[model samples]
Target: MDQYAVFGNPISHSKSPAIHTMFAKQTQQAMEYGVIEAPLDGFEKAVGEFIHRGGQGANVTLPFKQQAFALADQLSEAARLAEAVNTLSFNKGRIYGDNTDGKGLVADLKLQGVTLTDARILLLGAGGAARGVIAPLLSELPASIHVANRTEQRAVELAVQNPSSKLVASGLDNIEGEFDLVINASSASLAGSVPSIRGPLVADAVCYDMVYAATVTPFNLWARQQGASRTIDGLGMLVCQAAESFAIWRGVRPDVNPVMQFLRAQMTQSL
Candidate 1:
């Protein structure tokens, strides 16, 4: 069987092994998927050894996405624009990288019954997670997109990275008015927290927290109390992104709704 895996530090909690395993069975592909605990300083070497052992592909997370971007012999257009790689494929002594996070997020929103065309979007965060999705988000041609970050400087810096559309950066404190969708791409929810921002950003908008939980995440919960239309966590995004990578490897697109439903049940049971 061909081997595939996800590489990261602090990977004991990852759901990828299970997600990919299920995809393999569903798609009837002969592949072995698992998780790899790559040392912070040893990402490249670990990947090198995996390829040597016939590893066919990898899903990267956290601190390694940029390094994976640097390691790829070639990158897809999305990867080049995001400057990050969450998916990888090996071929003929070369490694290829792709960023499926943005596509995943967009797909998740669609699964949640969202209509993205010509709508206002507020993206919270200016880091890699946020960067990976901006190009795809812009490609949808939202009426406007305002990126807000706690560190206003970083948000401003990132806003300049994608200059082709209706996008700009603002300090969270200065943000005013409403949006059609407010996506929390920040890692703040991992700490059981929400972004510190004024109330207007989320009011009347559907809230999307890129962090998922058995129950509504803190960000989504707070958005609910604020009278947001609806709230969705990141479980769907996770499944959608995984499907993208699976398609890249197997040339088959597995339906993610079933996979997402399963993961949701697992998260609920765990809690």
Candidate 2:
């Protein structure tokens, strides 16, 4: 059986193993997925050991993404753009890196019937999560993407780095103009808080929080309270990204709907 795992610090809470296991079973692939809680300073060593042990590929999470990017022998366009690697494949003594986060996000949005063509998007936060999705989001021909961060300079820097006329940056307090979609990529939701943006930004707009929980995420709940047209959490993104990685490793895509339904049921049961 092919061996795969997700590497991260404090990885015990990750659902990647379950997601990939379902993908493998659905696709009839002979593989086993697990988690590896690598030490913060020993990520590279851990990856080397995994490769030596005949590990086929691995998913990366949190603080290890950048390290994975640096460790790869080559990078996919998405990974190059994001400067992070969430998926890694090993073959012929080469490590290939890819970033499926943005693709997963876009796919989930489309699946949920959210329009992206010529839409105005407001992306909260300028961190890695935000950076990983901007390129993919731009590919959909959105009219514009306004990146807002707590630190104005960081948002400005991120915008400058991406360098697209359709992209703009601002501090949360200075956000202006209405958006067709509002995405919370900030860590606020992890703390059970919503971003500090004005509620009007979400009024009649679809709100997406890149954080998921047993119930509605804090950002999604707040968006609903503010009259958001619809709200989506990151659970779909997680499953979709895992499916992408599974396809990369197995050369076969698994049906996501049944897996999504299963995970949703599990979340509800945990509540």
Candidate 3:
């Protein structure tokens, strides 16, 4: 059986194993996927052993994304641009890395009826997650894209490297104007918090939280009250990203819509 695993500290909460298992069963692909509760200092060793043990590929998460990015033999353009690697494919003694988070966000937005083509975009946060998605988001050619972070310098630095699009950096408080789409990529949402940007920042916008819970996340709740036209959590994005990795490793793109709906229903029922 082909082997795979997801690496993280508190990985007990991760849904990647179950997700990949579903992908495998749905496609009739023979594979074993599990979780690796890596020690804070042992990500490299854990990944090395997995590849050695016939592990075909692995998903990197949390504090190890930078380490995975540095350890890869090569990177996909998306991974290189983001300086982070969330997915690693081992082949012929070489490891190829790619960050599927951005791809997942874009595809999830499409499923939610939020079109980025020619629309104005407002991306919150300038951290690794934000960096991972910006390059792919720019590929969609939104009319304009603004990156606002609590730490202004970080936002400025991220904007300088990504000058291909009409990118601008601003402090969260200085965020002005409206956007057709707003993505809350900051882990703040996962921490049960939302950014402190003006409520008007989400006025008339379609808000997306990159973190999902059994119920709507704090970010989506705040966004909805700010006149957001639509609000969604990250369950769809998580499934979409997992499907992308499945397609990369197995060459079969499972219809994620059904899986997404299933997960949403499960979450709703649990609440």
Candidate 4:
């Protein structure tokens, strides 16, 4: 089997192995996927060892995506804009990096029947997760994109880095207007917290939380309570992004719908 794995500091909870294993089986590809827990400070060493062991590709998660970006021999355009890498393809001693998170999120949103064209978007958080999605979202030609963060300056910096006449930044508490779409890319949801943005969300707005759990995320729950027309979790994005990485490694794209259905059933069973 061609070896592949996902590398992260706290990796035991990752679903990449199961997701990629299913992709391999369905595509009739001879590959093995697993998880590698790199020590917090040992990401480079861990990647080196994986390469030495003939690992052909890997997914990167949390606290290490930026480091993986730095380690890449070359980067896809999305990775270059995001300045973060979630997928790495090892080719003849060269490591190529790409960011599939934004692609996945956009794909999932389209699947959910959310339109991005000329939409007003509110992105919550100024972290790497938020950064990873901005470029892809911009490609959709949204009317405007407002980034809100607890630390106002970080939001300003991120917007400046990806300057756009349509893009603006604000403190979460001072979010001035409603939006057609609201995306939660903050770690706040992982901590069971919501971004400090209070609303009047746009009429019939769609809300998305990039963090997923067995139940609705705190952010999504709050959005629903605030009358969002629809709320989506991160599971679909996760599956779609993994499919993109699979394609990157195996040169074939697996159907994401079946994998998403299977994963949802699995999550339900576990709950």
Highest TM-score model number: 2
1-271: candidate 1 lDDT, tens digit per residue? 8999999998988999989889888989999998999999999999999999999999999779999999999999999978999999999999999999999999988888887889899999998889889988888778988899988988888888888558879877878667999999876887898899877668889999999888888999999988898899899899999999999999999888788888888878988
Ranking of all candidate structures by their TM-score, best first = 2, 3, 1, 4
- lDDT of each prediction vs. the true structure? 0.90, 0.92, 0.90, 0.92
Q: Which runs of model 3 end up more than 4 angstroms from their true locations?
A: none
Q: Work out the TM-score per prediction.
A: 0.97, 0.98, 0.97, 0.97
lDDT tens digits, residue span 1-271, model 3: 9999999998998989878988888899999999998999999999888887899999989879999999999999999889999999999999999999999999988888888998889999999989989988998889889999999899999999888657988999898777998999876876899899889878888888888888778999999898999998889889999999999999999889778777778878987
lDDT by residue for model 2 (1-271), tens:
8999999989999998898888888778898999999999999999999999999999999889999999999999999889999999999899999999999999889988999999999999998999899999999999999999999999999898788999999999999999999999997876888788888888999999989888888888889999999999999999888888888989898888898889899989987
Task: Spell out the clash pairs found in candidate 4.
Answer: none
- Pairs clashing within candidate 1: none
lDDT of 4 by residue, 1-271 (tens): 7999999989999999999989988999999999999999999999999999999999999879999999999999999988999999999999999999999999999988899999999999999899899999999999999999999999999999898998999988888877899999987987899877775663478999998888888998889888898899999999999998999999999988998998888888998
| Residue 188 alpha-carbon offset, candidate 1, angstroms | 1.7
Models, CA RMSD each: 1.1, 0.9, 1.1, 1.2
Which parts of model 2 have CA positions greater than 4 angstroms off? none
Give the Cα error of residue 148 in candidate 2, in Å.
Answer: 0.8
